[model samples]
Target: MASNIPKFRFLTAAQVRRLHGTLIANAQPTQPALLESAVQSPLNIKYYNNEQNLFQLAASLPEKIMKNHAYQDGNKRTALVAADMFLKINGYKLQETPLQTGNVSQDLENAHVAVCTNAWTAEELGRFYEQSAKAIEEWTPEILAYRNEATEY
Candidate 1:
């Protein structure tokens, strides 16, 4: 039944840009989500399908959207929100975290490990963009378990 839920499909890289534009328009300077959609890319969908590994997918997100000095603050937080939303829509019981934490880079690193196990790395994550979805049709169940058990709210 969980699988029956229609996926929240994100179509094009341009759409992600639009999402970022919306966030920037709606938020104040310090608020996260200001430039979130810019980090989006079609590669994310390809990796999610191929790896069936949310952590790798999450880790790959920042490289796609974040630019040095692009946002004054909240870029990582915005990425986290986007990743959390992505996981929830795909039937994953995601662990919750304090929104807009001060330690975003560490948290993002942790998020990557939780999803990809030892396989999570920026270098490997880079490959997802070019890979075929058929590559990971049969993944181990352990790979499905998010490493950090999500907290019950």
Candidate 2:
């Protein structure tokens, strides 16, 4: 079945640079190769022309960004933020409680280590995204407003 989620607009290299600059303190500048990979990862997914679902797309994005080492530092942080933004744009969100946030952090660290050690497959990372995120049935007015505002810029 087709996913209910909307198609995603991948972050541009300029946008990634802006996000990194804004989010990281004294951040190391992004390399051209890293920026290209960051933009390409989602574009590849967007045109995969396969039967992949939205959760799979959401999950793969962070994994691709993180594993590709898209920044001199803060790859994990960037991956998480990019994935979250992708999900939000597609009408989903990661529903994390305080406890879940801790778990997610630990999971992210483990995933990083696994990727570094060549012990994790992209499929595994995609599964993690699917497990952590859920489709939103009803958005609160506040959340809707926030999403609207976020997309406006």
Candidate 3:
């Protein structure tokens, strides 16, 4: 059965670059090859005629982007933000708090290793995404308020 949820807007390479510029100091401009892959990744997922589900798309996004090295620097950061935005637009959010623990960089590094080494299969990654995220409707007012405040700054 198809989900009742509306399809979310996936990020374009330009939007990803804009996000990187906004968030990272001295961010490197996106290369053409990088931009192409970054733009194509989600479209490929969206249009795939296979058995992949939405969770798989969401799970594959970060891994693909991070592994592609779509940016000269901060590829992992860009990947994380892009994945989060994708999930948020789709009414979900990553539950891990690597940022709160000041381990985002480390987390990304581990994610890279896992992706490259096939430590987690695509289905497994999808399960991991499911495990790490929850519906936006479940967010507490305090968490929502904090998210709002954080976005504002």
Best-fitting candidate, scored by TM-score: 3
Task: Between candidates 1 and 2, name the one with more favorable lDDT.
Answer: 2
In model 3, pairs of residues that clash are none
On TM-score, who's better, 2 or 3?
Answer: 3
**Count of backbone clashes for each model?**
3, 0, 0
Per-residue lDDT of 1-153 in model 2, one digit per residue for the tens? 976645444555555555566655457545668666765665676576453466666666667667677678877766666666566656766644211356666776676467556687656766766777777777666345435543221
In order of TM-score, best first, we have: 3, 2, 1
Clashes in predicted model 1: 3
Comparing candidate 1 with candidate 2, which one achieves the higher TM-score? 2
lDDT by residue (tens digit), candidate 3, 1-153: 976544545655666676567665356655757655765666676666443466777667677777777677777666666666666656677644432334544554465457657786656766766766677776556344334432110
Candidate 3 lDDT score at position 41: 66
Candidate models: Cα lDDT each: 0.40, 0.61, 0.61
* TM accuracy, model 3: 0.68
Give the least accurate 10-residue stretch of model 1, judged by summed lDDT.
144-153
Model 2 stretches astray by more than 4 angstroms: 1-6, 26-28, 49-51, 95-101, 136-153
Model 1, global lDDT: 0.40
